[model samples]
Target: MEISSQIPWSTIAAVISWYSSNIGVLLLNKYLLTNYGFAYPVFLTLCHMTACSVLSYIAVSVMDVVPFQSIQSRTQLVKICGLSVVFCFSVVCGNISLKYIPVSFNQAIGATTPFFTAVFAYLVSRKREAWITYGTLVPVVAGVIIATGGEPSFHLFGFLICVSATAARAFKSVLQGILLSSEGEKLNSMNLLMYMAPIAMVVLLPAAILMEDKVIWITIEIARNDIRVVWLLLFSSSLAFFVNLTNFLVTKHTSPLTLQVLGNAKGAVAVGVSILVFKNPVSVVGMMGYGLTVIGVILYTETKKRYRL
Candidate 1:
């Protein structure tokens, strides 16, 4: 196969793990919110971030998969916190969006993140993508627009929050590269995560308190009544950690470009799994739009790769 020939077996493993973790966590979150009636997106995200911090800490401090180092400067600390705030917002919005929209539509909306990233890069960084790269985004945007129009499960508020989450994610990516890409400051995945998790918790605590804390007592009782719910939450949280770990591995082995290309397929995979698992309705026209978006993503990846951007 072309993939077996081109990608190392280890990289293939990483990619598989990445997809599994992403899809698994998403399905679990959907179940928690919809099936279990745990209506606390911010709190759930806080729990996942807590789990990630514990996992990263164990890897760095105990297993020594990555070395533990303290971030020294206030400026650097502020930057990490800033990134965390954006990350927390994006993730929480993503979860909330899922509460109101089907996973397939949510993932489809997320497929537009790259387009927003390019738009932001153009506006804020004055970076010029290749014309083809720019051209390819046309279909990406158009497909999302088409898909949005036809999506049977579309909710305007959910759509807006999902769009906001996608934009926040793009902004987070750009800001991270601009602020934290320095070799002297760079921490590997585990260590960077070690710092980011607590910061996200700190940043998220207030929001969770403001939004979800009102029902906190009742949700706690429900979680206690159902031990399986607790376990599922823990499982989803652990999968969240694996998602980042495997994403790092794949990106390290293959290029970020390869990971991006792989991610385009991930959208379709998530959609397919959601349909099979959740029995969410999808029209032929909607799928055509999703297919257009995936094709656009491939074209966009090729454009960026061809120009070495």
Candidate 2:
């Protein structure tokens, strides 16, 4: 399919915007991790959802585009709920993984999502992918293995959680792609997010209540004492909105494999920042692994051109 024709200037702009937003999110997440601790994901989700819901309501009220009463549809509702669950799982695992690993390492490993997504898509959709696509998987896997450095003492549970988060993200991408492709031309970024953010917020609420406990109350105390926490949460929420919108746009504009390449770059950027800003240590083995992973991504991208895979 000629995806370019499907994605107009607005979509391209959204993609760029989303990319910028993701970078901002990375920086914000790093700072928040250093200051507010890892539980920030729960708080971040809560604030983002609350803010989006309020903004959406205001937009609906002012524009009166579709009557609030008339906006309910079973299919849309279902899709929203599905997307929400996927988002929650992805974020929870991802957030937790950060507590155990540096952002850069997490991103490098996460870049393997395209390979996983392809594997999952082939199994679930029964689509026949080009053999070259399968070939590309070699370097992707190699890169991840190299980046991980086979550290015997590494946190196994944390690594597993991060991998699960990556898989969840990949699944979400494939599902969203299917949804967009089948839903006609009206499935724009804002529309998808409008439905997704609220549902995700709803899903997160109970999880936060159950997990946060007195820590939930503590976030308030922290926010009051350190105003930066509040700002971080607000920034994190905005970043979430931007990242979700851009990610969907990228999927719509380019192939899933291309998105994976971007993911690789994002991981590198995060790692670079973590090392510089947070002084996170990068061991020699970890550096070697990162090199292999990047090289694998390059090889995979180059291969995709000749094979349409």
Candidate 3:
């Protein structure tokens, strides 16, 4: 009873929410892009941003879920817009990779995010981790290399794009931390997402139009023929909002490093689900590599936690 009383139920709930939303969006995305033949990654990402913009407004302004925050200055608005660009790039590349790679392989690559986060932290904030922490990243890199060599359906283009997306994600995380670290500049997760979503729409619009061409009309036609596509898109967009919201909540309740550790575990879960659902071919080497990455991430997290003490 005493141990139960000490448990942080709220934080645990937030983490579960984050995992469900993250995995749902990811798997749905893979289904839409690969199996469903919706190959327009940019347009799909644009749809996601549009959903986020509308849903975020409804939640904040209409439902009063969280307190609304207004942009205080031009500088702050610019920073939000800048962050939106990176966010858009990260999301689009991630979606594109789904078209070419299995989700299990993608998750294996994603487990390396902590390594990129460490590098970006130093480059952006001049913050350095302990030597032991840096050493733990060694296996993270080795694991990805092994996973890459063992990927049955490895596409170089896909691998490169996935890696870029991972790096961009880390950079965005670090940049957000630094850019909004100030008390005056800080906006709660919901508000930050609320502001960034519309900006992301603006950024994604032209890219979708130029690169994807008439894919939007194709998506509409498909939706008209099959209502399931519409339902899928709607569900995916809603999940995306929850992903961002729960991500912020988790980080708020715990810490960013905790988020990273949870994320690594989330990657393992995603890998298992992807293999089960998609039946993607996997080799023993690939699984071993992914296991190594997970272990490295755990060590890295522990090292950071102990160093802080």
What lDDT would candidate 2 get against the real structure? Answer: 0.69
For candidate 1, lDDT tens digit of each residue in 68-187? 888978998989898888988899999999899999989888998889899888787887888878999999989988898889988999999999999999998888878787877776
> How do the residues 188-267 of candidate 3 rate in per-residue lDDT, one tens digit apiece?
87898899999999888889999987887888899889989989888888898889888877988887776777887899
Q: List the residue pairs that clash in candidate 3.
A: none
Error of 3 at 30 (Å): 0.4
Candidate lDDT values, in order: 0.87, 0.69, 0.89
**Residue by residue across 62-167, what tens digits does model 2's lDDT show?**
6653334322467656765786689778877877777677677777778777677877787778765678767767877886787677443356777898899989
Top lDDT hit: 3
Each candidate: RMSD to true structure? 1.9, 5.3, 1.9
Candidate 2 or 1, higher TM-score: 1
In model 3, the runs with Cα more than 4 Å from the true position are: 1-12, 252-258
Regions of candidate 1 where Cα sits further than 4 Å from its true position: 1-8
Candidate 2 has a TM-score of 0.79
lDDT of 2 at 30: 57
Model 1 residue 96 distance off true place after TM-score fit, in angstroms: 0.4
